[model samples]
Target: MMRSGPTPDAGDLPFELPRTTPRERARASALARALASAYPDAHCELAYSSPHELLVATILSAQATDVGVNKATPALFARFPTPAAYARATPGEIEPYIKSIGLYRNKAKAIHAAMKDIVERFDGRVPGTMHDLLTLRGVARKTANVVLGNAFGVHVGFVVDTHVQRLATRFGLVAPGASITMIERRLMALFPREEWCILSHRLIWHGRRACKARGAGCADHPVCREFGSACELRISAPSRATGGAPARAKPAALKRSAPRRS
Candidate 1:
């Protein structure tokens, strides 16, 4: 899947990006603008008071909802206000507060280990750089991008969560069947560097509110019509696979004036 795609530039470093046409990039810009106007105040939904708290919440957010994470974090953050505090407690000590979240045991372990790493390796401060952030337990490119962009104001890369991944293709911003890695690069190539963080926020809001994966009724929404006609064309849109890339529905599925309702 990682066919050498121009060794991605510094804008999207650490991964490869398939070459894009100027027209495609323009469409992406238009989409970003539409989302900006539609969701002017979009932001990271995860609640946190500090960089280390954000890092811990993000780790707990894997395969979990922000609502669930937020519900758990208030008490947890109040209890262990700093990485040094978390470092002193065992994972078991952190579990009760987060027990409401899915996979609480594992998340507690990851949070404890990551905090210990920060205290020992990074001097009790959350590492701001992507490379250093990834060294933490339970961190990957997505979590690293989240912490870097939101916590540190360093937009080195785009965050490719479920919403971003789905909305990217539904808006026709990337090639059909593109991998998540590829979708992220295509987005990087298309949008301005500074827009990466807030753009993700707005797009995620759109996905959740209008262009939902199930029972969506926004086919005629102005933004969807102008930027994401594919969102309405569910028959031809990408399946909810790993990358959220469209599957290119069979020709038989395209013979319709109105999309079939779910």
Candidate 2:
């Protein structure tokens, strides 16, 4: 069943998110300003000229770096330039191009199946809406958020990648241990609806460069000084902010799954 009519700025938000207090919104606003100032030009790093290319790149990006996905994608894109092109090929043909990426075999299947479905159902165009996009084989809420925000200019939800999740907890934008679904809704409630797209990019930018998951890269920055509580969380409760590092950081809560036709 497609999500009909108005879609909330929280990915149809499968879970109920707690409402934000005015104080929480004020703090979140300040953090948003700090991020925007720091990363004024933040944007999706996955290089693509079209929506379908972006979709495939984001799929391959699971457990793979954007750089790695970019490297593999040039040849792949040149070969299968459109949904029709990929739809014509078997998953085996798609495999060779993306073989260097993690889980190539499975990704090949996802890409092939998704593209084939697009051709058969969506008139070979990448469907821009969340419900339609989620029906594609490889897409989940996060991947859909990337495609929706960056490709289609539809910011229906916040993206919660590892960097975003870690930084959110560290910055106190979210408490430790919120599920990804809940975190997306919480961020949505805190930020202005129009800011959702750039907001995620900015968070990712700062997450990569400054307020890293392990520890602060440079604690002197004002945002970190005010919001950088992960260090304290680690000191007091090892499992909270740090995910008890020295051991492995907990694997991200999201996984690529067949979408719920709910």
lDDT of 1 by residue, 61-93 (tens): 887888888998999999999999999999999
TM-score of each: 0.84, 0.82
Q: Candidate 2's residue-wise lDDT over 36-105, tens digit each? A: 8888899999999999999999889987878889899999999999999999999999999999998999
How many clashing pairs per prediction, in order? 2, 0
Which parts of model 1 are misplaced by more than 4 Å?
A: 1-12, 229-262
Which regions of candidate 2 are displaced past 4 Å? 1-17, 233-262
Top TM-score model: 1
Q: Which residue pairs collide in model 1, if any? A: 238-246, 238-247
lDDT of each: 0.74, 0.74
